[model samples]
Target: MPNPIRDVAPTVADAVANERERQESTLGMIASENHVSEAVLAAQGTALTNKYAEGYPGARYYGGCEFVDEVERLAVERATDLWGADHVNVQPHSGTQANMGVYFAALEPGETILSLDLTHGGHLSHGHHVNFSGQLYDVTQYEVDPETGYIDYDELAALAHDVEPELIVSGSSAYPREFDWERVGEIADEVGAHQLADIAHITGLVAAGVHSSPVDHATFVTGSTHKTIRAGRGGIIMCDAEYADDVDSAVFPGSQGGPLMHNVAGKAVGFTEATTPAFEAYAEQSVANATVLADVLRDRGLSLVSGGTDKHLVLVDLRDSHPDLTGDDAEAALAAVDIVVNKNTVPGETRSPFVTSGIRIGTPALTTRGFGADELETVAHHIADVLDDPDDEDVRNRVREDVQRLCETHPIYD
Candidate 1:
């Protein structure tokens, strides 16, 4: 069948086809990325992007925004219901923007903020010196224990008390263990600091009840619509009703201008999808696949940070298993074999960020595509093999072929 859309809209069709091929050919192991549904993609490509809805529902800076207002309203409602948030702001363009809104709402410029260090599995927005969060605010970073590969809760409390930061951020890009939200909330309470949990990676798990939700404990929560949620690209911020206006204003007049209505519509759809029974099962399987992969890696004598994961991603410390292999080498070698994964910095990494000694792998996308524990075990072994021999072109070609067959057996869109 010759598709009319592909014939007429050549560029758009080519891009989508390329993406489909990319997904089919390679094993997607990135913890922070996912395959959104075609419906979500359709919404994101709609005419809704042309509308200029600068303000919230019933309060707009432009007319002809009634439909967009409804879309944004539906998105807000779904987000609140999914995460049990009191107030929702669905305007932020990215997770970083969502975090920025929280920062602008709760803390002033130059105020001290305590967060995890980037080198220790924390996100850049948490407090890297070059990021706006650190450049604008006095950021004091805390790190996980070098020996335990976990957060030192007592040390975090001591540092909070000593420095008296106005805000305490709890989140990570690579940390593998379940966060202690109760302890974070208590510490924030004691320090009179606002606590924000950036659960961008874990939102779907929390929503599906596979992991704990921090919305009830933290002053605010922010997450990306993608990742484990299988949503389209965008960010969301949630908090209590009292801080709603401040957060909204911070996102709009304080930082950005007009909101993307198409993205808002996609968010609405994604939120609805996340609340279903099928999504819950997918979330559960995602965690299960991660556990199986971790076990396979351990059986093969690979050292995973924190021993194993309680979430979708596993942090592999390659120092003991592949002593000569840097993270960059591992990522390249795996990518050559169609096993796509990103290099990450484990806690107390002895190497630099660009060439660190760890790799972050996850199972959400594959689990969504119907790969189970056995499939993941096979993937783990293939990954180990690829890393064990980076220079073998024939091995890479064989792994690529295997990935295509596996992906065909469990196609994403089907």
Candidate 2:
């Protein structure tokens, strides 16, 4: 059957088709990415996008927002249920914006913000000088222990007291261990700081109870709707009932207007899916697959940050075992054979961020495709082989065949 998109907008249609093919063919191992359901994809493409719901549910600047209000209300309810927050704002455009909303809600300009270092697994919004949070706030960055490759809560507490930050951010993009949220909360409390835990990369893991949640501990929690949650593209902010109004105003009139209601519907749908037992199993399996992959990689002589994983991703420090191979080199080598991973900086990295010494491999997307520990171990062995000899065409060809076989068996949108 000939599609109308091919007839009317061939160029756009071709790009979309190519992306679908690319996703279907490749092993998507990017830690902060996942393949969302077709239902979610359809919901985000609906006519709700045309609506202008500039305010919260039932309180809109524009008229005829009833349906969007319903969607937004449902999204909030589901997010609240999953995350156990007194209030949930499912309207930030992305994770960074969610962090911005928290900042606007809690801190005045020039106030201090203590957070993890970017190279030490912290996110950009946690006070990278290039970001709005840093420009507006006095940013103090912390790092993991140089020897252990883990956050030292005592050290963090020391820094928090020294800085006396107005807000202390606890979260990471590439950290492979679970944070002691309670300890962080204690530091924030001792220093009279509002704790904002941005679980942007592990929203699903936290929601599924695989990771310790910060709802009761932190003053605010921010997350992306997509990553591990499989929600349509957006961000959400969760807060206690006391800060609800401040958070709401900060998100709407303060930073953005006209909520993406279609994405809200998608978030609602994905939240529904996440509430099911199946999603819990998927979340657990993601971590298990990562654990297996880490073991296999370690057996092949690769160095993992923290020596293992407690989540759905592993950060491979290629500096020790593969001294000649930069993360960029390994990323390109794997991408050429359809195993997609991102170049990432390890703790105490010496190279440029663009050309990092480590590669971050994740299991969420592949786990979404039903790749279990055995399958993931096979994938890891293939990864080790590629890293062992990126210059060998025969090795590349063999791994390509195995990757294609796995993709064929576990289809993305069948």
Best by lDDT: 2
Please report the candidate that would top TM-score against the real structure: 2
TM-score of each: 0.96, 0.99
> Candidate 1, after superposition: displacement of residue 96 in Å?
0.3
- The sequence of per-residue lDDT tens digits that candidate 1 reaches over residues 1-414 is 787679899899889789888987677889898888888988898999899999889999999999999899899888888999999999999899999999999998999999999878889888788789989999998998888888999999999999999999998889899999999999999999989999989989998999998988899999988888877888999998899999999998998999999999999998899889999999999999999999988888899998899999999999989899999999988888788899988877889889999999999888878899889988999987788788988888888888888978988776
Model 2: ten consecutive residues of lowest lDDT? 52-61
User: lDDT, candidate 2, residue 58?
Assistant: 78
Instruction: For candidate 2, report its TM-score.
Output: 0.99
Model 2, global lDDT = 0.94
The superposed Cα distance between candidate 1 and the true structure at residue 2, in angstroms, equals 7.7
